[model samples]
Target chain A: MSFALQLFDLVGIFVFALSGGVLAVRQRLDLFGVLVLACATAVTGGIVRDVLIGAIPPASLADWRYLATAMFAGVVTFFRHGSIERMRNPVLMFDAAGLALYAVLGTGKALAFGLSPFAATLLGIITGIGGGIARDLLVARTPVVLQQTELYAVAALAGGGIVAIAHALGWPQAPAMAVGALLCFGLRFGAIRRGWRLPVARGTDSDS
Target chain B: MSFALQLFDLVGIFVFALSGGVLAVRQRLDLFGVLVLACATAVTGGIVRDVLIGAIPPASLADWRYLATAMFAGVVTFFRHGSIERMRNPVLMFDAAGLALYAVLGTGKALAFGLSPFAATLLGIITGIGGGIARDLLVARTPVVLQQTELYAVAALAGGGIVAIAHALGWPQAPAMAVGALLCFGLRFGAIRRGWRLPVARGTDSDS
Candidate 1:
């Protein structure tokens, strides 16, 4: 990744960690618990992506910057949670930004690892959602991604698919990534503001 | 791993998948949902272990047999759920057995990848509980391992610690693994049957 992209990755990790830390504070978990959730939420998605691509000791584990950034976010959130709680649904924008970056970046990495384009795209989607799922599960909240609310998965797929398609066509990385990220963020932002949602299964009482 | 260990791995996957399948049926999830949960439960731990150790395309993804076994378990559970439900807390035994196998195997694999014994032990514990956690979270159950009512994490730690210690002492792998698995299963069984519990943080009304 370019220096610009690497910087964006840290930013994404920071915001995602903030969400985890805020949740821990709301749950009244101790300092250690806050830090644990923060770090786990920030790193899990990338860790899963790296692991699948055979990258040992994932950047989250091997590179101190990733964890350091998470801890910093955690400590800050711990002290400033009152301000955060006062904000209106603060984590949503952070999540959309992180999702967009992760989707594109994860797709790029998987392609670099020689995965098939389809597999890489799927991995990208997983990368986008994995951390959020972990954070929600840890805090005992039902996963919002699985809840058929907003166009979360659709936005990620759009971002990841753009990267994969660009790669197959030998397009320049920076431009492709920029457009992909913008599209993902736009889609997610629109979905949130305009109420785009997938139609869930009907007939609540029906089952196999 | 040796042939016997590999066979046990399959058995572990089967039993764990059975738990997921049973849960899905009880929850009245559709057939696709049932298979998804079953496969997710069966393969998540090994996938995490392999990813941490730089194993590409983790066996759960690379090999067909692991998924085949899980699917088989899911299909059987779907059909025989009446019989399974008739049994007494059957999934508890299956979970303990799977936990024991995963802990030892995960530890051994981590060591083989040259991680420090402490790190390997921790990884082993994560591997033991990872699948169960995923299964519960997907179905909106509080993670059983995180609940203070059970000795799940402790049993996994003991089993993983034994494997790490045995390796550090240059003990034979086969015997060490057998003993480790037995110890883990025994501890978990006793904990569940005897209602052993961990101390929970008091004063639920308190906040930071």
Candidate 2:
């Protein structure tokens, strides 16, 4: 990865960890639990993506930067949770940025590894949502990505699809990735501000 | 990776799937949800093990039989829910058998892959509990492995430790694996029969 993208990844991981730490505090998890949830939420997506593409040990385990960033975020949030929760909109925005970057990055990596477009796109979506799903599960909550009204995964899918399409067309990667991330961030921002959401299933529970 | 071990792995996966299916039914999940939970719970342990050990695509995803067995178990449980629920003790026993086998198998694989004994033993414990943890998390329940006084992981740890120790001593694997599995199964069985449990922390909530 380029230095710029790698830097973006650390920022994203830090924000993700902070959000997880906040949730852990709210759930009354002790310091150890908070750290676990924070670190897990920050790295699970990347680890899963790397594993799928045959990257051994994963970046989170192989390098100290990602884990240190997560731990730092966790500690900060643990100490300043009340203030952080009060700035929910900003946290969500940062989370959207992280999601966009992960989706784009995962897609690019998969394509570079010779995965087909369909598989690459799917893996990208997994990368974007994997961490949040893991964090929610650890807290015994239904993942927000699976919620009827959430638009999280769709935004990720769009970002991943963009990167995949760009790669398929032999387009310049850096610009395409930037555009994809912007689009994802925009979608998430719109969702938060305008209540944009997926249609809820209206089917009867008896049959399903 | 031998034929016998592969067959044993299939049996373990089948039993694990059945347990997950039962849980999904109790949760009132739909057919699709039941199948997903069943398959996920059956394969998660192996997948995590493979990913950690740099095994790509994972044997569970690579082999169609693993998925088919999980789906078949889910379907059987869906149709025979009442009968299966009636055989509670038998189901638990099967689950224990699965756990024992996974612990032994995971340790053996890790050791074969040139991991340190400590890491191998840790991976083995993860392999035994990973599926069940995923199953519980999916249903929005706290994982049983983290529950106070549950002896599940300790049992797997013991089993894994045995294999690790044996490998360290340059002993033949087959006999050591069999002994480890037996010891694990016995521990679980004894725990069930005699209320065996680990001690709980008695520290004040104010401090931790």
Candidate 3:
């Protein structure tokens, strides 16, 4: 991965870990539990992606930096959890950013694995949302991905599509990545700011 | 794949789903979130095991029964959540049983895939704990597997090892599976009852 891409991934992991830590604190988990949650959120998606694509030893296990980053973030959050609690919108904002970054990075990695563009895009969305889904399941909540909230998957698709198109047109990898990331970030932030959401089915009269 | 084994798998899934549903209620999750968590906890480990062993489509999506079982449990919990809350210890005991069942099943499936016994045993542990790990991460808590609790992994290892040994001895598959499952449950139950625990290392003075 390019240095900038790597940087983005690191930052994304940190942000996601922070979100996990904050949520753990909110749930009154002990320190160990909080740290585990942070690490799981930060690394689980990449681990799943690598495993699916047959990357032996999986980057999450091989890369010490990712673990260290998550560990540091978890510790910081554990010690100063109250500040995170005070930020009412922190989880939403951080999770959105992490999703955008991860979606782009995952798509880019899929392309690197020589997958079809559509498959790459789909994998991107999966990678972006998979960890959170895993985390939510552990915490016994519905994952945001399945909720009728803003079009999170749509935003991931848009980002992945942008990267795929750029790559098809022979754009440099860096530019392609940037375009993907910007698209994801912009769409997610816009959705959050404007409260954009997909329509939900109305219950029938007979529905309880 | 034996009828008896399949029956146990279905029972394990059902009990596990019930535990997951109880957790959802305890967490005060909404209906959708509760169902998602229940299904995920009930099936994600098997899904991961199948995917890792290159079992096409994975069991979660291939067999409708697993999804139906989990969803039904979720709905039941929604309607009779009060009953679940009143039976906390039973719910936990069932969850522990499911963990052992999944672990053995996963190890057996991996072995059937022609993986080495060692790998199969490892896969069994993963399958056993993976769903709960995923569940915890989603809810932003530490995974129960990594906690300082009873000898969870030790139970999986014992069960998986017994299966491998039975295979080596050319024992009948049905008996072998039963042995494996029984070993796991027995050891786990023993640990719970006797308060068996692994030793933890304190931080070094240099670090302090």
TM for every model, in the order presented, reads: 0.62, 0.62, 0.57
Off by over 4 Å in 1: A1-39, A45-54, A62-133, A140-208, B1-3, B169-171, B205-208
- Interface root-mean-square deviation for each candidate? 5.0, 6.0, 8.4
Distance (Å) between predicted and true CA of A27, model 1? 5.3
Model 1, A1-208: lDDT tens per residue? 6798789899899988998887776666655457667877898888888877877777676566787899899888877776766663557787789999999999988998999889999889888888888888886787778887778888999999999988888888778878989999999998888888888777765763
Number of the top lDDT candidate:
2
* TM match of model 1 to true structure: 0.62
* Model 3 lDDT tens row, A1-208: 6687678778888988887776665655555556667877888788788777776445654556776788788887777766766674866677777888888888888889998777888888888877777666656677777887768878888888888777677788777877777888788888888888888778844685
TM-score-better candidate, 2 vs 3: 2
lDDT of 2 at B37: 95
Clashing pairs in 1: none
Each candidate's DockQ: 0.14, 0.15, 0.09
Q: TM-score (0 to 1) for chain A, all models?
A: 0.93, 0.95, 0.90
Q: Report lDDT per candidate.
A: 0.83, 0.85, 0.76
Task: Report residue A149 deviation for candidate 1 (angstroms).
Answer: 16
Q: True contacts preserved, each candidate?
A: 0.19, 0.23, 0.10
Docking class of 2: incorrect
How do the residues B47-153 of candidate 2 rate in per-residue lDDT, one tens digit apiece?
99888888767989999999999999999989999999999889889889999999999999888877767668767987998999899988878777645445787
